[model samples]
Target: MLITFKSKSSPEVTMYQEHAERILDVLNKNHTRGVITAAEAAHALQLLEQEVALSKLHPEVDAAHANHSHAHHLQDEDETAEMADKNHIGFAQRAYPLLEMLRAARDGGDNIVWGI
Candidate 1:
């Protein structure tokens, strides 16, 4: 898969490219066969694409708006504390499944199966 960057101003803008063969070589060397499922591979690739896009945009955008690109990072300690006070039950309900899934994966045999 090729990754390209287009700027409003110039054709001279650098377009970063990642060859699939190189990615496959790295993955083959590092991971066991069947350890990463198709969905997981797709999700990882999606995240990588997002990170690359964000890296290209970051310098051009304001810091506050930068966090908007990845919403998960916007949840700060103060936000968590405020959430605990306002909706303890709701917070626990949302958090428990994620915690449980993480625990199960960490104490693993089978790979974690995330819904697509």
Candidate 2:
């Protein structure tokens, strides 16, 4: 299933459940659908935007992600793709627009809602 994240301050962003769950997990939130307060959204947005810089400051984050991605020992093409998907590089690239939307929502004091 797909999840549609909506905020009155910006255009909506719809992503597959897997992608959404990964993003949510990065924010240290439960992998479930619900409303996110403006404050929470702001905090998450900051982290998402600073992913690269923060990765430098906190090597453990990158290490954990690396370890998780490499845990799959399969050498098949699909497994390779899965590893790539779990990597922060591609996630950061794809998350730009989602972060922008969250920023607008935060600035506007609007909550974000999904799974509706």
Tell me the lDDT of candidate 1: 0.34
The clash tally of candidate 2 reads 0
- Candidate 2 regions exceeding 4 Å error are 52-75, 78-89
Quote each prediction's TM-score.
Answer: 0.22, 0.66
lDDT of 2 by residue, 21-78 (tens): 7678777765557877888887888778777466667766655554555556556866
lDDT against the true structure, per candidate, is 0.34, 0.72
lDDT of 2 at 19: 58
- Candidate 1 structure quality by residue, lDDT tens digits, 1-116: 23222222222112112222222333342211223343354444444444445545653342332233333544785664454445333222322332343334434422433111
Report clash pairs, candidate 2: none
